[model samples]
Target: MAEPEDKTRRAPLDAVGRFTATEAVAAALSLIWLVAVAAYSFTAPDGTGPLGIVMTLMMVFLPIALIWVTVTTLRSVQELRAEATRLQSAVESMRNAYVTTQVQPSVQRKLEEIERTAKQAETALATFTSRRDASLVVASADRKAAMAAPARAAPAEDQPALALGTPAEDLRAPLSVGDFIRALQFPESPEDKDGFRALRLALEDRAVAKLIRAAQDVLTLLSQEGIFMDDLKPERARPELWRSFAQGERGRGISGLGGIRDRSSLALTAGRMREDPIFRDAAHHFLRTFDRTFAEFEKTATDAELVDLADTRTARAFMLFGRVAGVFD
Candidate 1:
């Protein structure tokens, strides 16, 4: 409604025949000059020849022609004014957009959240890097210590052998499937006392200890390539599918168990397998270890326990690395 009213409003130069104040004033002056010229042409003291008639006609219309030309120039000026108004409107809209962006609440919060997550990932990666090297050192040193142990403590030939002391692991309770899954996730942080406790208990089991060590090595190596189990979100397979895998099913029958579908992760793993010999070896070792250990555990694991195990970070890594290794194909 307001737009219609604005369109109807008067302008100096409109679509209809109209004149500006200056143009009207100029026309009035030109009319007066024509009247004076008519009076002189009729009442001239000199002879009224054809030359005098020609001069009078020129004087009559020249001022009106000049005024008409000036009005056309003023119409061009009016168009320029309209364009300047539109440009001013566009500038105002841009300023309003800038103000709106500044007031959005999530902008600042999202930035902070992203920064915090990146720092946490960096810390976890660094921790595992050290653990990977330490595990290698500890495994080699243990081999050396075990080989030297028999020579250091020789059995007596005649004297009665003293009763052998109980092994260190005999004092600790056996690791349960639940504890094994928790241990595979590893301690969330230094303050995660419960998580650490579960890991320590799981480590007491001879078979589980080997699987956990292999998992840690593969996890640490994958992190070096910027892939983390925490970042993967595998599509959860059915418990029956997991049971089939545990029961030695292979190929497409159990292919649904490979739930990791992130293309970028698969590409990275495939590339690493092709280019990095150490990473490829570690991946193969982890998968074989996981498959054998998990099959044994599945014999006793309830459907709920199986689901929980599948949800563990270690299981997720298996899905990702195994798919790239053609375990699901």
Candidate 2:
């Protein structure tokens, strides 16, 4: 009875195996049919049987149709891949930008705070230095006074006090045309090409001679009007102007014509005169002369004459003034 039961189980197992094997064989045969159809359609020549001709035509038509479907499938897959890559890159870029934007403001604020603190410190240092210098001057004055008292007592009979000499005239005068030309010849850099050209043209123009004469006349008139009262008074002339003049002079060593060689220098000088009470009165006198001179010159001058004037020495001087005033530089 047990043997019969075992035989029943074995029979069912055998049937299941047979069914699986049959299905596998059928699937393989279907694949072989598809392959054979494809190969036969492609390899078959023309002018054969009607069935063979039909198969050949089908082969041609079928491949074209299949190619489109294959290409579409491949293109879809490529598009999906590209889209995925773009999305990933965009997400990464956005994350980086967000991080940078969030961090930058705090850094900028700290930098600003540091700069403000540095400026405050500089101001405090300058103030302290000024006060210290003033104290030193006061102490020196006291020492001189104490020494003068003893000298005065002995000066009547035994020792004669030395007479003080007048202040020495500056040996180095204001820049001359020759000096300006020389400076242009040896400019500090290639950037001075335009300036060199302008200067050269002005030097060649006879109108520049007239312009210089006019400028000198203007200067004389200003002096006569007492606008230059402080030209004789060292105390009245601000140290700043002298310093600027000195710097301009020094710049001549490198470029020959310093910042003071331009039109802005003339304007600055005029502005300074305006600020001074005595100079302002003198400037008014010169202003009238300037207006009259300029009007006459303009009225008499044609465009050609004006161009000639621009090409002269006076124009070069004007250009120099402009450069000094920071307009050109």
Candidate 3:
């Protein structure tokens, strides 16, 4: 086929190889002409005999050899130009990659420096605010003392016994912020102590106990849904993370929850509390109890052995879940 012939075609490396091939062709032609001339001279002793024949053949073959050389030279030039273009493109690509590599670290360092500066500014602001708050507290105490001194001295002997704020008479009664504030005040006398005892007794009522049981049921439900109390703690310190978890984007804030496993269970449990009648009533009761109790509860009671009842993990969960469900609204 023509393909095999094309592959096997002679290609000269340089002008020297072309010249050598041309000379070889000329030498072969000259030898043939001499042989022809010798035979003709013997036949006719004066011979212009083969001279015309040799010149005609030379004219015909020389041009063919020149044309072959010109074509090969043009093909080689095209191949060289193609290789150069490819090399230029590769070099451009490498330059872009090198620039990206060189710039990344400096950009990253600049970003880190900005973050550090922002943190330092936040720390300074926090310190200044704390100092300002402390000074204001001291000044307010001084103002109160100055205003109350005369009135306090005259009424010290005649003042009636102070009373402690107790739980409301009705379990479902809505409590006000002012009622809670008054309840959180320190017990100052035997009468106040008696009031706190009565309040504590009232908190043990069956209806209030049902609220605690309801909170426990919620905890159990979450357990079945594959969420746990320990899992909620780390989130407690982070408001946004906790918010995400409560919003049904459970896996968004917890990396472990991102796995496909437990995904379906979480989906099934997401709004079940709101949908189920039993859980809905329990949630309502728990929220009502929590709101009224939290209002009347003393913040300092968390550390007190007798009144540390509301400081448990279960109680904390109720408060957190109540907030997320808009129960305290």
Estimate TM-scores for all models.
0.58, 0.26, 0.30
- How displaced is residue 258 in candidate 2, in Å? 14
Superposed by TM-score, candidate 2 places the C-alpha of residue 11 at a distance from the truth, in angstroms, of: 60
Regions of model 2 farther than 4 Å from truth: 1-35, 38-71, 94-101, 124-329
**Residue 257 C-alpha lDDT in model 1:** 84
lDDT of each: 0.74, 0.42, 0.45
Query: Which portions of model 1 miss their true places by more than 4 Å?
Result: 1-165
User: If both were scored by TM-score, which would come out higher, candidate 2 or candidate 3?
Assistant: 3
TM-score for model 1? 0.58
Candidate 3, pairs of clashing residues: none
RMSD value for candidate 1: 12.7
Candidate 1 lDDT tens digits, 1-329? 44553332333236235556867777788888888977886697764799976776677787778887887777678766766666776788899999989867678899878976865564455334432233323322112211111124567888777567857665654565556778888988899997898788767777788888999999998898899888887876767788888888888888898899889888988999999999999999999999888887765555555666787888998999879988888
Q: Which candidate is the best by TM-score?
A: 1
Q: Arrange candidates by lDDT, descending.
A: 1, 3, 2
Model 3: residue 102 alpha-carbon error in angstroms: 3.9
Flag the better candidate by lDDT, 2 or 3: 3
- Candidate 3 structure quality by residue, lDDT tens digits, 66-165: 6657656765775566566667767888999999999999999999899668655654553344322333233221122111111233436666655655
lDDT of 3 at 230: 41
